[model samples]
Target: MEEILQLLSEDARLTDAQIAERTGISEAEAKDAVAKLEKDKVIRRYKTVIDWERAGIEHVFGFIEVRCAPERGVGFDAVAERIMEFPEVHSLYLMSGAYDFLVVIQGGNMRDVAYFVAEKLAPLDHVVGTATHFVLRRYKVDGDVMVERAQAKRLPVTP
Candidate 1:
């Protein structure tokens, strides 16, 4: 299962036959494992990460700290749903502490973000406040580094 996950994580394009051949498992078994992984929500979904600059999207990505009134129920959930419905929102999370939620937003420029804050988010009845912080650059993502360090640690010499 670990190998299956690792292989899929490396590249989700691999077929069951390929995974089976590499893992020395039967194709049927490999397929079944993948099915179970999905059914159990282990493998939730596959997504492609695009390079914003290369994609020609002149948009900036940022994290928004949402301080909302958590009265009860989906107070946060409802607000998050509304935020996620916007094309500008990439991700949303119900958080703890000072902020009730965290939002990932993309926009054409500062004006776009400001417009969203003023016209959309701030106007929501449940919304208490929001703080936007722009991301200058991404150094690393999903533990996959731009510069991979060589496996330099020496292994024990065995006769």
Candidate 2:
């Protein structure tokens, strides 16, 4: 299972036959293992990581640190749910600090981002205030270079 998972993590697009061939398992066993992993919620999702900026997204992406009221009982989760519903929000996390949540958002310009904050996020019930800082640049992403290097290494097997 660990070997199968390693192969999938390196590239989830591998066929059962390929996985089995690499992992030294029968093709049918590879299929069953993948199915069971999905059923057991071990493999929750397979997602594509896109370079949105290179894909012609011109504006800056920013992280907003929000201070919200804990009186809402569910704390930041309720507010986060509302925030995530917006298309502009790429990601949100409940943080442990002076701020309750960290939100990642993207927009075409500063004006668009401002509007999203003022019109949508700020209006949420427990939200107190928000501090936003735009990302100037990204040196690395999702450890792509590391993954590419790992992929380049030949799998150890007697084929």
Candidate 3:
């Protein structure tokens, strides 16, 4: 099961037959395992990591450190759900240390992100404070390298 998951994680496009062949298991068994994983919500939706720069999409990304007072009984879950409802919030995580949540958001520009932070995020009930850090560049994301470092061009040394 672990091997099947590992293979799928590496390449989501692999068919059940391919996975079974790779793991030396029967196709039916592989299919059953995969179906069980999906049914149990162990296998989330498959995702495609895109290089937005290559796609020529102009956008700004920001990581917002949010400090909020947790709601009684519900804790951070309630606040998290409210924050997640916004389309600009790509990802939200309940974090440790000084911040309560680490929110990843995207917008057209700095102003758009700032507006979202000021008008949308900051005004939310129980939201005490926030620190927004704009992403200047992305070297890598989700285990995929976004940018390739250039090789140095130099003459060969001879003795």
Candidate 4:
């Protein structure tokens, strides 16, 4: 099962037959395992990591470090859920250190992201403070390098 998951994680498009061939298992077994995983909600969804900049889309991505006061009865989960309900929030994570939640959001531009922070995020009851950092470039995402730097050209040494 672990082997099957590892293979799928590397390339989600791999068919069960391909997985069976690679793992030396029966095709039926491979298919059953994958189906079980999906049924049990272990496999959430397959995703394609795209280099959006190359596609000529103008997007602004920001990482917000949020400091919040946890609610009395529900704790951080309540605040986290409220933040997650917003469409602009792509991902949210509980973190260690200075911030309670690390939020990733996308918008048309910097001003749009700022507007979201000011209008939507800040008004939340538990939200204490937020620090937003705009992404200048995405060199790598999900272990895939988006940009490859060119090699420097050098003159041959004459000696």
Candidate 5:
């Protein structure tokens, strides 16, 4: 089961036969396992990572460190649920250290991201403060290197 999960995580495009062959299991068994995993909500969704720079699409990614007051009894759950409803919020995590929540957002430009922090996220109930950082470039994402290595160029030697 773990092997199947690992295989699927590495490459979502793998067929049941491919996974079964690699794991030394029957193809039908692999299919059953995957079906069970989906039913149990273990396998959330398959994803594709794209290079927006190469695609010529402009987007700004922002990481916001949020300081907030946790609600009584519910703690951060209530606040997290509220933040999740925003379309601009790509991801939100309850964090430790100086901040209570780390919010990842995407927008067309820096001003768009700034506006979300200043108007939407920061003004939320229980939200005390927020510090935003823009991602200049992504060298790696999800263990996959974003930058492709270039071939070394050598100058011609004079005889």
Candidate 6:
């Protein structure tokens, strides 16, 4: 299962037959394992990490460090649910540091993200303060390089 998970994690496009070939398992077993994983809620969603900039799609990302006051019974889960409900929120995490929640937001522009933080996020019931960092450029995302690295040209060899 771990082997199947690792392979799927690296490349979600891998078919059961491919997984079987790599993991030295029978195709039927591989299919059953993958099916069980999905049914068990282990494999949640398959995603494609796209280079949106190269695709000519203009967008902006903001990393927001949110300071919050947790609800007595729920801790941060209550506020987390609210924050995650927003369409702009790409990802959210409960952190252990100066900030309580680390929120990643994607928007059409810097102003749009700023509007979301200032107008929407800051006004939330338990939210105390926020520090937002706008992404200038994306070198890599999800372990995949966004830009192609320049290859070194070989010098002419004389015999």
Candidate 2 wrongly placed segments (more than 4 Å): 106-110, 146-159
Candidate 3 stretches with Cα past 4 Å from truth are 149-159
Model 3, position 152, has a per-residue lDDT of 94
- Candidate lDDT scores, in order, read 0.84, 0.82, 0.91, 0.93, 0.90, 0.92
Model 2: weakest 10-residue lDDT segment is 143-152
The local distance difference test score of model 6 is 0.92
Our model 6 lands, by Cα RMSD against the true structure, at 3.3
TM-score of each: 0.77, 0.77, 0.84, 0.87, 0.88, 0.87
> Residue 47 of candidate 1: its Cα lDDT?
79
lDDT for 37 in candidate 6 is 97
lDDT of 1 by residue, 1-159 (tens): 999999999888899999999999999999999999999999999976666665677768888898888658755667777778888887888886889888888757878988887898878778889998988876675765544378878669956
Candidates 2 and 3, the one with greater TM-score: 3
Candidate 3's displacement at residue 30, Å, is: 1.6
Candidate 5 local Cα displacement, residue 144, angstroms: 0.7
Please give the lDDT score at residue 123 for candidate 3.
94
Worst 10 residues of 5 by lDDT: 106-115
Model 6, 80-127: lDDT tens per residue? 999999999999999998899999987588888888988999999999
Cα RMSD of all models vs. native, in order, equals 3.8, 5.0, 4.8, 5.2, 5.1, 3.3
lDDT digits (tens) for residues 3-74 of candidate 5:
889988889999999998999999999999999999999999999777888888888888999999988899
**Candidate 1 segments whose C-alpha is farther than 4 A from its true place:** 39-41, 72-75, 146-159
In model 6, the clashing pairs are none
**Could you tell me which residue pairs clash in candidate 2?**
none
Candidate number of the best TM-score: 5
**Candidate 4 wrongly placed segments (more than 4 Å):** 149-159
Task: Provide the lDDT at 10 for model 6.
Answer: 94
